[model samples]
Target: MSTTYEFQAETKRMLQLMINSIYTNREIFLRELISNASDAIDKLRFAALTETNLVPEDANYEIFLVPDQKNKALTISDNGIGMTQEELIANIGTIAKSGTKEFIDKLQNHEHLNATELIGQFGVGFYSAFMVADKITLLTKKAGTDLAFKWESTGDGKYNIEPASKESCGTTITLHLKEEHTLDSNNEQNYLNQQTLQTLVKKYSDYIRFPIKMLFDIPVQESDSVETKQELKILNSMAPLWTKNKNDIKPDEYNQLYKHLFLDWQDPLDVIHTRAEGVFEYITLLYIPEHAPYDFYQKEHTTGIKLYSKNVFIMDDCRELLPEYLRFVKGIIDTPDVSLNISREILQQNQTLKKIGKNLEKTILKNLEVMLKNSRDKYLKFFKEFGKAIKHGIYADYSSHEKLRELLLFPSSRSVTEDSLITLAEYVANMKPEQDVIYYATGKDRQAIDSLPQIEVLKEKGLEILYFLDRVDEFAIDMLAEYAGKKFQSISRGQLDLSKFETEQDKASQDKLINENKDLLEAIKNALTEKVDEVRISNRLKSSPVCLISSDSGISISMEQILADVQDSKIKATKILELNPNHEIFKTLKRTFEVDAQSEQFVDYCKLLYGQATLLEGLTVENPVDFAKLIAKLMK
Candidate 1:
């Protein structure tokens, strides 16, 4: 007996919306169905661990698809754990109404719901078949059960359930392909034929563990006659390349796997295959791309490694496996120890899953260290593309700070070209015997920071200075206050206390310049007032008369600019104005200040000097018009 039942109202709304527009490409329906079939097989495999009889020893488990072009019907069958009559009602007869309602709420909330992401995240992936089919018929019989069921629906808010029979326990899904999805020369994409179906399985489900077989009629050309004969073909790769041993795998095989996973024409930069056993068993196959995707850093771009549990594809791009900073790393991870039946939420919080993530993080960093030491030419090429994002990991991953620091590539005062990068270890090794602090300067780029007044002083002292150009460089290094026992000192942020390196006579001469300029410094500080934190004689300037430096407790100039660029609501830092007492302009200013202590010329000179110093710090002169007038008056 068959009875027509009305669908839960919310299910109908979600189904309608998804069928019409949720999945951008109708062909994704095949991928979703294939994934469901694969999951069913995984569930049964896990169950048989306790019940040996659940899976017959001789029974071969797999997926089979048969397309009837003449009847415009497509059938996809899988011999796995089938659903009981009651289970069918709970799983398919009605999708969880609450899930549908939440989807609607998120839709109205204008979340970033990419159509590709929606196809499988929700429980309604089976309904995606409706995109290419007007009606669907399902036949399923639970394993070790005598009864079978047939569920039919046109997806018009009503479905029919009746007792049915199957030769074996499993599920068979028949789709009545719509007019557009049938055979036609005008239709570029049709699902009613063998060729299109084979292509889709290879494209999306090739990584599926089970052998997906398709049966179709092939034209037999004999010398005397031409006839059609049915033939079976395996449509999917039974064992994905990631499951194999890294030592046994060849370069070409790794490249082929890269193409299969990403569908990219170019090969990967390199591939790392890591398998962890013991407490947390998992396999990580990561590929370094030859080039980044176009929208890799875009706000809406999706990136993460494909996730699998017990050889079953769970989801693509599971962000929980890696920090957001390492979004560029792409590949897959398979963990049999993790449960396949758990929700993505539970998987995220699972202790075993987290342990697998930490192990992967360490392994990736270790792999990078080897590449940098042995294959710098290629590593440098890769760093040129994704080095900034890798540094972002240093600032974000609190637990893996030291490991991330090892992979950083930096430009230094001794660097000749843009690609010349040195590690902190390398920089420290090259440091002057008297130098104990890692001196660095942050700016927009190598050229901009190269011209900084502080850099000139370091150049004169024969000290190496690291150039931090990226916006995130300061934050990442700030988190790591020191590296290899040497503390980081920003040349533009704090005082240059190289007194230990200076000879006693040199120190006395430097102190003499500061004492002689003491009176002028006091007058200049009063003149500038709140515009600067303090006015002092410079020990870190040469050609430039005045230079700006941040207080030791405050932020660097580059950091301040970053906060400003981001439009942060926090208060900005005030700069310390340091005057080069040795410069001719300051010597002339001191003479003029002594002559007329209250003259407007003296005040104009102080403001003009402040404007010049602010410009050197990579900040704009607040009042350009007034500064121009002051300069014009001084020139006259």
Candidate 2:
């Protein structure tokens, strides 16, 4: 007997929305149907373990794709568990009704069922096929049953179910595709093309446990003529390396997988394979490349981990899986705990994804910590290529500064070679008993920073100074503020309090010298009022006559330069001039001050000293030609 039924009012509304708007991409239709077929097979495998007679002991299981160009139809057939007449109406007649979900609920001991292998959580996946097809016909027979049935629907809120005949216990769905999808074209959109079917199966269902096979026409050359031969080929690999036991995987296999997946010829610097179970089960296989990609720093470069749900590829670049700081990381994350809407095109912003991201971040950081502890050389090499990106994390978020602080490395005054870098903890550990602050200097490079006059006093006192050479080094350090109870002090930006090394007599002598040369210092300050904030006697400079330093609360020279370059704005730092009191230039200024305090010669001497100070601090003079002329006049 044939029966006709009208879909529920809500089912009609949802079906229209799904067919017209829910799915954003048409290619996703094939993935949905294939996932449904895979789930059907998984259900049968679970049922056969309890009911031995449900299926033959050595039954061959697979999903097949057949395209008929003449009929303008594509058929997806699977020899798995099928539904009876009542089961068909109950599962397919209603929207959002999942047979797999009900099957899992009925099991007394859920452990007996391998739920991870089942892909269909919501029954709506079957409707996705309607996106490409105008009508669908389904023929099915339940396992261990002789009765068969056929269900037909045009997706217009009506369907027909009737008794049918079949020789095997399985389900086959044929899609009467729309004209646009079936039209012959050179593009891959043609639904009846074998190449198009193979591509879609490999992209979204390559890791399905049961083989997904398709028939292809291959040309054969006989003795006198060429003939076409039809052969069946398995499209999916059916095995994901990350799903297997990590112990069984070899090191060479990991290297090859990384190279093939990422198209990188070189072996990775390291590989991290993690499996988490219990509350939420997931597997992560990550790789740290030996070197960064050519476009790693380009603005258009995209990055994220490949996301999979139940061995089915969900998204190629799932940005939610990793933070921007870890963008250099490349890998895949497969989990069955996430919630997907009807289209399966977007992942909801749920707690499951957030927890997985947090876990992955912690795992990567822990792996780096281990590498740093056990493999110093390898860690340093990795740092050299990606250290700037790591430093960005500290500046962008204060909460991560402490976590990433220990992993930071910088070259210091005590470094024996270029590659010898010290951590903040190491610098703090080796601090002198009298040292109360962490001192650092910034310049264009190590050599420029090494020659700065402000750090001369620290070197004389046997204190180590960290060299901030990278453009972001100063900004990142400023964000850190302090480490190990020692506040960061920029050597070239503020006053150097070497009072711990000064004696009572030395203090008194410095005060007397400043008072005696008070007139000379004021004359110099008045001359360069626009260029400097103040002129003072220096206890910091040893071999140099004068240098420029920023006020304690003002921006450092390096930071000012970086901001100007990045923003293209004219922002200047508050400059303070420090004159070495014991240098010969001081004696010459004092002598001239007594002779004629307001003379042009005295003013000229002040300008010359300021120009020289600018050059010593790695800055350009306002007028190099004038500076040279003044120098020549003074020499004559």
Candidate 3:
């Protein structure tokens, strides 16, 4: 006897939504149905462990894809624990009522069932088939039961169930595909095509523990005649490399897996595998690529990690699994704890994923630290490729600065080679006995920074000066502020305290020289009134005659350069002109001012000195032609 039933009010509304708009891609319908089939098989296996009479010990468990092009029907068949009439009504007739969830709860205390890999969390997955099919027919016979049942639904807010005949225990779902015109008008997927089915199976269900099989026509060449024979081929690999123990897997296998997953030709720089249990169970197989991808810095680039649940692929680029700073990492994260909505395509906002992200960040950082402590060369290689990204993390995430600080590397004045990089800890450890601050200089590169006049005094005192070459370096360090109790100071910015290096007589001479040249300095400052904030005698410029510096409070000169490079940035750094008292040019300036304070020659001398300071600061000399003419006049 057949009985037709009307769906509950809420169920009817949800069924229509699931059929028409719940899933973004119609192709996901197959993934959902296949996941449900896998779950049914898992239930049967788990039940068989306690009840031996449910099925034979040697029963073959698999899911088959059979597509009929002429009839426009696609069938997904699985030999597992099938549902009875009551079970069918409870699981299918009701929306959001998860049979898999109920089964797991019922067997919560059963230790063997805990190991069972069930993929379905929400019963709504079964309804996703309506997206591709005009109607669905399900036939099933529960194991150890003689009676069978058939459930049919057009997804028109109702379904029918009846007792049926079957040879054995299992479940088979046949989808009557929509008409060609209907499919085209609705933009529905055509699953009757064998190639499309195979591709979808490989992409979404390749790691199912049970084999997913499909019949393929094999071409045979026999005695100058070609014929095709049908053969059942396993479509999925069935073994996820990450699911296996690390000790059991070889290094080459991990590299090959990385290459296969990321499509990178080179081996990964590092591989991290972690399994967390107890409160939340999950497994992560992460890879650090040998080099950044071409689109790594582009807005269109997606986060690298893919997310899965119970080895079933969910999303290709799960951004929530990693923070923006670690977007370059590529890997897969699989966990059953995630609360997937009805579609099972996206993650719901929850603390589980966030906690997992925090754990992953710690793991990746620990791996990097190990590489840094034990394998300096390899760590440096990674730093050269990805250090810029890690530095940005310090700027973007203040809480992570202390952890990310040890991973930072910079070139110093004492670095013997072009590639030699020292850490902030190393710089602090090697500080001069009298040094109270960490000194750094910013420029386009090491050579430019080394030539800075302000660095000469620090070098003379045997103090190391870090070279901030990257555009973001200064910004990141500015956020860093202080490291290991030492405040970061830009050598080219503000005044330098070199009193410890100066004798009383040297300080007296500096004071006397500045006192005597006060008029010359004031005259020069007045000549270029708008260009500089102040004119002062410099203790930072040891051998160089002049240089440009920024005030201690405002934006630094390096930051000004960076900001200027950005379009429509009108901000500028406050520039100060500093002159060395011991340099011979200071005497020339003093003599020129004493000879004729209002003379064009003295004004020209001031202009030349300002031009010189500007050039030394890695800035263009404004009015270059006029400055050149002045230089020529001075030569005469």
Specify the highest-TM-score model's number.
1
**Tens-digit lDDT track of model 3 for 1-636:** 999989766667655654544333566567777877877887777667557889987999999999876677889999989988888887788654324344334334332321112212223457667766889999999987999999998989988999999998889999998775134322335676666778888766776678999898789999999999989989988799899998887778777667545655468899998889889899999999888765576676778797877875566777877777788889999999874322323354667888888889889999999999999999888988889889999989999898899999999999999899999989999998878899999989888988888998888878899998898898899999999889898998887887877799989988897898787788889988899988999989878999999998889987887788875577888989999888899889888888899889888888899999899889898788998999999999
* Candidate 1, pairs of clashing residues: none
Between candidates 1 and 3, the TM-score winner: 1
True lDDT of residue 106, candidate 2: 29
Q: How far is candidate 2 from the true structure (C-alpha RMSD, Å)?
A: 15.4
For model 1, residues 1-636, the per-residue Cα lDDT tens digits are 998877777777766665555434677778778878877886776566556787786768899898887789989899989999789878886776344676666555544455444443344668878888999999998887889999999888888889987878889999998887885834646886678888888777776778999887799998899999989999987787777877877788677556545645467897889888888778889988887765566766667598887666676768777777777788999899877666667877888767777777777777778999999999998888888788877787777676678888899989988879999999989988878899998888887898888778788889999989888888999988899899999888768897977799979998998888788888888899888888887778888898888888867666777887787736667678998877898878998899997888888889999999888887899899989988898899
Q: TM-scores for all candidates?
A: 0.70, 0.65, 0.66
User: Each candidate's lDDT (Cα)?
Assistant: 0.80, 0.81, 0.80
**Higher-scoring candidate on lDDT, 2 or 3:** 2
Q: Which segments of candidate 1 are over 4 A away from where they belong? A: 1-205, 210-213, 218-226, 247-252, 259-265, 292-303, 315-320, 323-325, 500-503
In model 3, pairs of residues that clash are: none
Q: How many clashing pairs does model 2 include?
A: 0
Model 2, 113-217: lDDT tens digits are 321112122235677677789999999999889999999999999999999998888899999998988887555778888888888887667756789988899
**Model 2 per-residue lDDT at 74:** 93
The worst-scoring run of ten residues by lDDT in candidate 3 lies at 113-122
- Tell me how candidate 1 scores on lDDT: 0.80
